[model samples]
Target chain A: MVKKKFAETPNFTIRKDFRPLDVKEKGLVFVGYEISDDKKTMNQFLHYDQLYTIRHGWNSPFFIGLLEGKIMGTRCPKCGDTWVPPRTHCWNLDCNLQRTEWIEMPKKAKVHTWTVAGWSGRSSLKRLPIILVYGVIEGSKTAIANELHGVNPWDVEFNMPLKVVFKPKEQRIGAITDWHFEPADEWEPSPMNKEKERIKKLVEPVYEWVKTLK
Target chain B: MSRKVCIIGGATTPFDYGPTGFESIEGGAAECVREVMRDIPDFNLRDIDMMIYSHFSVHFGHQLSAEWIIHDHLGLVGVPHYRVENGGNTGGSALYAAALAVKSGQHDVVGVIGWETMDSVSQSQGSEFIALASDIRYELMVGGIYPIYYAAMANKWMRENKVTEEDVALIAVKNRNNAMDNPKAQWYRNEHRYITVDDVLNSRLISYPIKKYDCCLMTRGVAFLLVTTEEYAKKVNPDHYVTIDGMGLSSCTIRAGDRLNFPGWIERYGPGYPEMTEFAACRQSAEVAYKQAGIDNPLKQIDFGEIHDAFSTSEAQIYKALGLADSENIAQFIRDKETYLEGSIPMNPGGGLMGYGHPVGATGLMSAIEAYYQLAGLIPKKHLSSKTQVPDPHTGIVNSHAGTGTSISNFILRRV
Candidate 1:
């Protein structure tokens, strides 16, 4: 086919109903179309588009940790403040220049606040009733908003204990949705096991830690 | 005591999706300029020293140099044109820029216009575009949408205070009814003017505790305001003008979590609570503005307010933040109708962003234009839809915000 200057791409005026004629044969992306109320003229635009990629520097550990079935946040060594969905530096000005240390959050968390989303934006339409909940990780100082799953909406309550349920290893991706939360049953901690668990927690960093070399 | 700035005249298109000429957004811009010129005799493109245009999410229009497009469409090619964008607060920011231009004496008269074209795409696409204003990495990535975030904030406020869904619904009802009188309002023509609290309560849920009616609609419209030096105002209409008495701007952390200072509720829910000081942007802005205007008390000194009611719950929070009411008495302050037009201090008499329609970029300018009408006492009888109007209002405030209480820009307008 001979490439025509400005003639290769054909433009079609929209009909009164605001529907476009078959342009699939032209191999053009249907960008957008608009119609006037008087129906005198209808305009449509089509063109080549670009998909941009997002880079997560200094925050890759948070995403990588998700794929590893771990929830993580950054801890300010100076202020002893914990941030989920981690940051690279301390939020407080007083703790200036204090590089944040990474810590894997506890699997156990509680619903701090929540909302049942019946509608969502274009990106998450298929994930309706998003059951978005701001959860307070058991050992963290802050709450992180994430999807809550594996329970009826009406059963959810404030301060309800929940456990993280990770996606299967093969299907796991380094994203926030890699794991969701479910209700946790009450545990009557036996006195003997409680002491051992406490000792183990103290010996460990309480959360997995990672750092970047300067 | 810098040079004073006054709004000589303004115009706004009736909030609508479409029915324009081939120019699309440029057509709306032309209409605004034409109408404002018609409103002010002898006013033309030649008098404008500078132009400030407010537009959010340029991708929605699929155009660049939008400010120039509007400027050139008005036949002012060489005129200095600048674009001011700060999410939903774009309009307010543009107005502030215009005021600064006149105050600096760099421009004797400036034209500020705010226009948005969300209707150019589908509603879902529009929502997607708006969601970009939020913390995309954290919020949007996990399926968090714009209205859902507002809904969560509403839930937090209700849980902290003993506010009921009914109270929030009352705000929607009042604003929807108020829109009935505002001929330019988006909901004015619809039967929604008679929407009851139950109607809002029973409406389809967009997010829990926040029904569809509780949220503002994504509208497409344009609003323009002309700010000129006091001397220029005298040249135009000496006796009739609204001077920008005071202005204030402030911003806060993007993370909503950082702003919650509610210890009582956070302890109970294992989460942070909504603290008055946490949402300090608006309060700080209102305080600086009132102080600059030489007003000691805003609740008592200001006659009316055209606040940013992007969501119903935001109105209540703003009331507390602006010192319109104390934490203990805020619910009563709103519930008692003190903010009604007939009450002590009228709020959003023209329905606000809720009833008036929030075309993002145009909302802040819409508030200022509404205040201009109230301060000038020129609000057409037909457009005066509030249950009551502040009698002979001398001063009013226009509150504008970006994200969920992110950036705050306010201007106190007084009849000169």
Candidate 2:
């Protein structure tokens, strides 16, 4: 066979190795790899930028409220049920649903449950043995799972009063991390709202289809 | 208008923790398929009319289009082949698809393979690869690794049920002991096969409430299954004992918060808490499977069980969700060893994910394989091992779940 100036299979013929310079930008992952000219040797390095913007959509206002040091919610005009995550739609399955009205939520809530993690992942591991509490946001059926800080681990109890503490202005951002919960001495107890609309039945065909699956 | 589906034969490679020594995905898959073929006398690749491969991550093995790679390696060029990726339950989901293929009458015989090679990379990389299955926008962005999510669920379950670390430790101990009888299981040869509650409680914690032993080992392996029609099965193996009677697959909302709103749920643990074990998907899938199998009560109807014990806590949660045990007393079931091989309904006779090892994509079919062995009376003759085998298993249920209960598939098999 005649030697050609260029081979048809580019991957088969490894060229000179190329080195990738590090990029310092946040939220971008860069992976580097090199193969020898003989296509016999290879090395690779994976670089990850863990931060990224998560679109909150209709829930953006909820995060935005934290930046303003105000807890916000959306009340269903139809059934008076409120969601602290600030949903655009009503939870009420009945009645002609309308756009929910944005309402400022009470800063105080009660811890429904909590866990003291002796371990965590990359983002939270730095604060090892972090305490996470699932709190029922006061005056709303919505509950938020957030970091419970500034409280003794042994002192934490179910249904204990917790108060949301927004980060300072310099630290504030439109994210779930902009606030954390702390033990609160005084907060009003909200009236028990009618059991937030229970999804009594699954969507048709799904429930019907489950039993008839091939 | 579906035809009856039967499992003619199946095989699973011994699940090994890393450095599997397989060069390519095709190599492991082809070897697994060959092993399955060996189980069915006179069977060959040509008998398969179609193939379905289940694999969750192409990143782990640095391989893509796995079905094509597998089919080419098997030398089944003309075989209609495709791949299914459903997180951890990929195996069972693909098998369900294979059953549908046979039931559709388009093909009487189909091959299903679940293969994953995570040993190609480091353990941390494996964790990251699996975490990709979670909701990237919410769960993954918020410091969520697999163990943290499961730990959070365990925290809620333990708090609500008044269960302690020692109470849940029995699950890990039972499954590990059972693995001693299974040569194919991961810890079958370990000197610490029988870990005590103290061992688990004192072990290094991955995420609080989940110890090292509570989690399934990061393993690499492949499992294969051959599904054929009822008539076709009879012709091939007149004495074949197990036939897949019913299969149910259901998915809940990917967001943990939304999962709590699944129909008729009591959100005792608040948002994201119920998703851990009370996966509406599992309940829905079990309901469908039980109804189709004519099972009124799984606790009594199921002779044995093979559950997705990705974590010991998950198995306990599944036990309650499946109605295999009551919610308030799940710890008692474990404490009493009620689900042990010699218990009322022996579960994970072959050690389950905890013992058999979890190769993600392959774990579901591994459950299927264990259930098949139980229904077919293939217990190996070892005292402690045979005890894990139920006395006479005629009906069984194998549960498969993925991504913190995002996807669930249940298979109901009977020794007909």
Candidate 3:
């Protein structure tokens, strides 16, 4: 397969602007400028508006499996260690970077730990009060992180059983968000503890505050 | 054996500079360099044999190869120099590298200059840039910002250790209150010089268990430290210097999830241990440093500590890692005021990252500078106040961590 040139890619774009601003402070200059020998030319801010084209490279199979409604992981042939969010090579010093083989991971997992995020990076700010969890899938030695949904954030619990829920085929983008975790058939949130109650009290107000911003 | 390395002098710009603190990175760095030169007797730029630049991300300033520009501006262009980038550990890692250079006899006197100008972008944009430091493919995709990542650990740790939200808030209160005595602390410039634990509990939530006050300020500032061999240190300032007794650096998996049921968790920490909640790298780093420093009991042997409290939760976790407190006694440790300036094994008397602004590259070096000043008994003279100084401190430890303890460096400094 041939890759498109960056110039021809749909995600590539450039933004340019030039404006003068007041420089009142003796030493605080907004932009750094360099002049030519003849003092004619100068330089200022330049902006690049482009989306990165990051390839999965050796981990392509893992992403490919996501779109196919299956979770893929890597297994070390030498040591029999399994990894989700798969690695191309074994990380163990004993294995010595041996090439790893792909294996289909079980859809079920147990919540190792979690947090209810009231704020996030700019892109995910709108999805406030998001539940993020690190889940250890069955038959895998390591855990993978993803969003947890279908249950109230306050109701999330440790060691909760969960099953992977993939986005519809048309909505799939081969990204990690292509799937998320939801409560398994037999799982239920336990009664709230004092520690969790405190978190709930702190986080509830944030939801209201976020609504005001929106 | 490597030659002994000592920090003879150090200086830092006020952390409240905000973004656009100076005309350029060079301008900010030059100010710090000049301050260090003036602060240390008979010391000047000419004394710096090599320079290690600690800078975190190029995304902030949109500039690459910034170390060269700062190097040229400092009039040390001919000297060997390179930049070190390790997320939040940039400062400590750079200092570690500089110490090695001095210890190996490659350079008798080394300078570690660290700075970050983060106000170039809005807070949200800055958060986005910082989140990119995580494993972008897995963690960042799931909306994992620093606060959220730390909050996850906080939740598990708090529940297991029986630590309350109020207990975590006490850290914010202690650090910020301590900051009032620090002229360079960001909190020192705040309208409200002191905040109560209730205020922290009521503060807006960034992520569950991590409130607004619990977070460190995204700052623009610079810190400089002069590390040299015993000969050079004695030559410059014989009366005021701290010897680098022990330094240890360690790293772990960048992805927090991978630590779950970690390979050696049960063997190392005992059965039924919550692995991801603890900072294993921090413990490993401190273990190495303590061993080398001949410290059998850190809480009793070390006089004080300047910890990497990127979040209040991290500080609590680090207390256990540094052997200051254990899981069962951590909450009680904070409640009993064991971590305050006047307590046994006082922690962060100079205001930690929470109260002191956190300019990623400069933060670790700032902690080292505080350790140096405290050990040398220069707090009252240099900071213009004795409120934040530990009494007759002979040993102090500085910890710098990055990426959810993905990388951690611990240094034990001794009054010489």
Candidate 4:
């Protein structure tokens, strides 16, 4: 009879010997999700210079006007509603809201609510410094999420007065460029959001824990 | 417990695993059924009475593959045919279902068939498809693979007492060597000896504790059995017959995610997770089998047998669950070569799903076939290097479990 091998390969083997290992006691699931160490065999590695064409239209001055500290938005002459960040089309389904106006307005709004992430992979924000906020401008509001700087993440409250703060270009990524909400130092927050009770009951504890990283 | 059902007739196609370029699943199933029909000159195809088909990947023919296509393929069109899908346990469940129908007097004779094809579809997809047997919300959604299913057993089994991955590897090596004697097995790829524990440790990781080698390969093939009463058996095959002596089915947690924690599950099932536990879906089938057969102490009373070694861990647990391993010296049992074809209780003598090529429906029936052979002394004894071989003592059993956690069927086949 020919000697056939059914279970012997470096990558795929079944041990016949009766020795043991202490792997299972560690409480770690045997398979790792991420390939932990770079086991690439060949030496060439990847290069980055081949892709820069998409970065050219990045920071035009018209886009920089908001960073220059003046109020900015896209205005509709018909409904008198101010839209910022200038979307190309209107969301008004009733009257065909389209991108038809460019206008300027005040930069202030009131904070509706916030949350701070308690955990992170990096030693970031000193203490959980990220904040998610719902801000209302003249007649309209949109929820914007960003990291809170300078102030404590846990101290943020609903209905606190706020203004947009844009970081310097040298430290920013070109996409979703720097712009976050900051609270006015003296204005205390009013508990007025619609889901304020549930929000307070659920989210604030996490927010407080996050503030300690700083 | 109820009276045992017997296999009057059975058939097989050349073990087609679809992508293996053998016959397709339906073609293989039809061939097996046709072979059975040929053996039983008096039995009529239209009078199949009821139908139970098993499948790993129905691909498109899930229910209709064995039922619709098989009916058309074998020329038995109008009878009701239902497909059984339970991952690796389907074959065992298929046989159990057919047995139950025969015992219930639902039909004079029922055909149980199963098949699987892994070469055409990607292994990950095939596995992901079977992973559906686990709870979607918690365990699977968390990216747990099949080996992890048994790895948890390996972990707890080790913590509670002592069983290592190497012990599992020893079982794997044994199964592979056993498959060498079986031309019907799926592990024709390599010799199991000479492999070391370090090899299993270094294999590609799928889930912690489960490496690529620690898992079974997905093969393509079809297998089936015909179940009926003693009267029907006498009518179909008057000369050859094997009765269900001590069958047992136990349920385990089908989906592990729903429970508050995992340990709550083992409390009901005992050693082999849900397969032996009251929580398992196949509990009724097992109870009826053990009671009808009058087997109160399975470990001591029953002799050599086969089981659902979907993973090597399962084999170990069943060793204890059935009370065979003696617990005090299980390692000595394996190292001394006790659990082999000549061991005190030889399990999965057909190579098990680990090496037999787990093609769903065919696995359980295949185990049944092995049981029938062992009962009749058809199997070549322990392969003493191919040329030298001899037979061993009698009394055999085959335990199979499916993915559903509910479909477990343990079969006890004996020679008169």
Q: Against the true structure, whose TM-score is highest?
A: 3
Chain B only, TM-score of each candidate: 0.93, 0.93, 0.97, 0.82
TM-score of chain B of 1: 0.93
Better model by lDDT, 2 or 3?
3
Worst 10 residues of 1 chain B by lDDT: B269-278
Point out where model 1 deviates above 4 Å.
Answer: A1-39, A45-49, A139-141, A187-214, B20-23, B190-192, B261-278, B381-389
What ranges in model 2 sit over 4 Å off?
A: A1-59, A63-66, A69-81, A84-104, A186-214, B62-64, B141-143, B189-192, B259-277, B381-388
Q: Write the per-residue lDDT of candidate 2 for residues B68-91, one digit (tens) a residue.
A: 877888888888989898988898
Alpha carbon deviation, residue A21, candidate 1 (Å): 24
Q: What's every prediction's RMSD, in angstroms? A: 11.4, 11.8, 6.3, 21.4
Highest lDDT, which number? 3
Docking class of 2: incorrect
Clashes of 1: 4
Please, what are the lDDT tens digits per residue for candidate 3 over residues A1-214? 9976765433526322222354233432345556768875554544444435676777878877987888999999998989897888887666888999999998999998888888888778878889998899998877788899999888888899999999999777777999999999998778888766877787788778778875
Candidate number achieving the greatest DockQ relative to the actual structure: 3
Q: What interface RMSD do all candidates show, one decimal each?
A: 10.8, 10.5, 1.8, 17.9
Model 2 chain A: ten consecutive residues of lowest lDDT: A195-204
The DockQ-derived docking category for candidate 3 is: medium
lDDT of 3 by residue, B12-61 (tens): 88886453345467887888877877777498788788999999998877
Clashes of each: 4, 0, 0, 37
TM-score of each: 0.85, 0.81, 0.91, 0.58
- Per-model CA lDDT versus the true structure: 0.76, 0.73, 0.84, 0.55
How much is the lDDT of residue B85 in candidate 4?
A: 67
